[model samples]
Target: MSDPIEAAIFEKLAKADPKNVGGKSIEPADVAKELQPEQWQRMLPKVKATALGLMRQGKLTITKKGKVVDPNNFRGVIRLRLPTEAETAAALAALPPVESSDDDFD
Candidate 1:
């Protein structure tokens, strides 16, 4: 199971406009404000952490200066967006090869 905040972050990023169309990207603060309008300031850190988690899972992208940055090493400002098709392919390719089970023969 995943945290609710993480899920919300993914949902928001997924619905955001494509970079090629409108060049839309979401700041962590934007999500924090949307999820917690009253205490948005307090939610910023949590929102950023959740966004990073999603990025690590290959379901999201974190960019700095319009280019993807290492999720493990970035600072200052960042934007969250759904991974481009090329990025998605690269991420999928980088995954460990799956092992087949004997049950598949049944």
Candidate 2:
């Protein structure tokens, strides 16, 4: 149920080898370019936001120098890749606990 751009980003990453296997990660520009070959530059911010959303969902990983970086606080060049098994586990663990509403008890 993802939008076209989000779908494109996932499709691109799904095709790339996981970074744990010596696969070269992709930059936001790469997805942006694929989504809009001519005006790809205009797509950078959207691409980045989508990537961050994916990472937060534990479906993706954002890394710098081969180490995962906090999605909320990152800068400079970064690479995107499908999260490895361990990364997925860690991401799931790092997620904030959800609280149920009191009304749910009714």
Candidate 3:
């Protein structure tokens, strides 16, 4: 199984280039780059947020037992399983529609 934290860190370092991600196309610069100690420290929360966003968007989930759990609980060094179509649909449907804060503007 793949590691989600490594994947996300790869995504960040790779600048989200699809070509540089996955399989033989993987690049050393993609996942090899590491932030400075201080920067890496600051990035922990952002990394968690990104993981959560991916989960909420139904791209990934936490595998517990035989089912996927919400990725909101994904902590450090954990991998997230990709969600199925039905699971993604359910997740999307459960979310409230986006609201416009400027809707009342004249």
Candidate 4:
């Protein structure tokens, strides 16, 4: 990915597992830290957007309070993680195309 924020988010998620994230889902702050440890807050929006892009692509899922939330319009705190194969496909099918070009990822 060309976007450093997206790459950082994926890098952290890629390490998700019992031994990595303690089986816990990742938050935008986590990816922000990877991108700019000294100022993670500034990276929050980009990280969140990247998470949304991944969700739209069937690679990630967004959740709030342990329940899946709509990727396009979720409010409040959110967590990110890889989705099950079926969930991924279903989520991808349910959403309309928010992105135009393949290179237009957030």
Question: Each candidate's root-mean-square deviation in Å?
Answer: 3.6, 2.8, 7.9, 6.6
lDDT of 4 by residue, 1-105 (tens): 798887777677777664543335888888888788998899898888878888888887788998888776889899987787887889778877676666755
**Model 3 compared with the native: what TM-score?**
0.45
Clashes of 4: 0
Judging by lDDT against the true structure, name the best candidate. Answer: 2
Task: Put down candidate 1 lDDT per residue, 66-85, tens digits, no spaces.
Answer: 99987668887888888777
Q: What is the per-residue lDDT of model 2 for residues 1-106, given as tens digits with 9 covering 90 to 100?
A: 5577778776776677544463457888988999899999999889888888888878888999999998879998888887878878887888899997778555
Residue clash pairs of candidate 3: none
Superposition error at 106 for model 2 (Å): 7.8
Q: How many steric clashes between backbone atoms does each model show? A: 0, 0, 0, 0
Task: Report how far off residue 39 is in candidate 4 (Å).
Answer: 1.9
**Number of the candidate with higher lDDT, 2 or 4:** 2
Candidate 3 per-residue lDDT, tens place, 1-106, comes to 1755557554553454445432222222223325334456565655556556666776645444445555545333543445567778977987789887866656
| TM-scores of all predicted structures | 0.70, 0.80, 0.45, 0.76
Which candidate has the highest TM-score of all?
A: 2
**Which is superior by lDDT, 3 or 4?**
4
Task: After the best TM-score superposition of candidate 2, give how far the Cα of residue 50 lies from its true spot, in angstroms.
Answer: 1.0
